[model samples]
Target: MITGIEHIAVLAKDSKALTDWYVKLFGFEIVYDNGKGTYFVKAADGSMLEIIACSGDCRPTEPKEWGIRHFALSVTEDGFDEMVEKLKVEKVEVVTDVAVSPKGIKTFFFRDIEGNIFHLIFRPTPL
Candidate 1:
């Protein structure tokens, strides 16, 4: 039977830099560094992200890309606001500013160093 997701793989032009970016932004720690362009980072909640080294530059994801549009990392409501502010202070590209839905879910989106769009979501109730 299929279980939870093991990891989400992303291609990075510079694997080491991308790995460091996650470590700096989020609290993700390096679990494995294959020395070749592949690295594994483990998030605080035990989620894993596999970064694969690639040669070409990464382009921002398009909504019609026929694949995953974006992936989100959950954060507390307070953390959500703090993250949005931090992103703004750091001059990072903010795709969508913080907004609260009618259902009370707060979310914001931004781009990473590799041009990957990531969302920070906060749900009043746990999923």
Candidate 2:
């Protein structure tokens, strides 16, 4: 029934700000924005992360939810430091600073303006 992750939806209080943040931080371009509370962001790989505003009863999920804890993005080993520097320039909050895992991958965690945590990681080089 499931093939791969099509998109992840996030509830946004300020859709424009969220859209702009992704654009500025990771170079995500806006594929579509309805102006009524729904917007779609796409990366170079065609994966998308959507944001929709809630009104009366709609609510965003907490991190402890049973499904979809958070999203992870892979970066190149050489690009790891450059990526962190870019995030710093944008003034985004980095919850977990860069660190190397036992498996030899370099990783870091950061949150969007809306508090959605995302991980950026790079694979280790061959010995």
Candidate 3:
């Protein structure tokens, strides 16, 4: 049986910029970095996001990948606003405006510097 998400890995062209963006926007801290192609990030809930540099002919998904289309982060209301503001300050493109679900959760979508979409979702209470 599937337990849970192990980690979401992104092939980074500039891993340093990606790492810095995550740290500044989402409070992700570096758990490991070897000054090489690999780095690990630790979220507040202990989830991990790994960044690995890819070379030669490699490219990000082109809207036709088989699975794991995108990644989302659940944040508090305050965190959601804070992240949005930070992105705006940094001139990162916001692809989707904030929207509320029928279940009353708020979510907004944005892309990383490399065009990787990530969602910041606000869940007011337990599901």
Most accurate candidate by lDDT: 1
Model 3: residues >4 Å from true position, as ranges?
62-66
lDDT value for candidate 3?
0.81
In the range 1-127, model 3's lDDT, one tens digit per residue, is 9988878888788888888778877789999998896889989998989988877765555445775556888888767777778778878767787899888799887778877878888887766
User: What TM-score, over all chains together, does every model reach?
Assistant: 0.91, 0.81, 0.85
List the candidate numbers ranked by lDDT, top first: 1, 3, 2
lDDT string for model 1 (37-94, tens) is 8999999889999999886656667755877888899998778877788777767788
TM-score of 3: 0.85
The candidate that wins on TM-score is 1
- Cα error, candidate 1, residue 66 (Å): 2.1
Clashes of each: 0, 0, 0
Candidate 2 residues lying further than 4 Å off, grouped into runs, are 56-67, 125-127
lDDT score at residue 16, model 1, on the 0-100 scale: 90
Clashing pairs in 3: none
Q: How do the residues 1-127 of candidate 2 rate in per-residue lDDT, one tens digit apiece?
A: 9877878888777778888888888888899989797899998888998988755654434557776556787788888899988887877677788999798898888777777778788887643
Residue pair clashes in candidate 2: none
Give the root-mean-square deviation of each candidate in angstroms: 1.5, 3.2, 2.1
lDDT of 2 at 78: 84
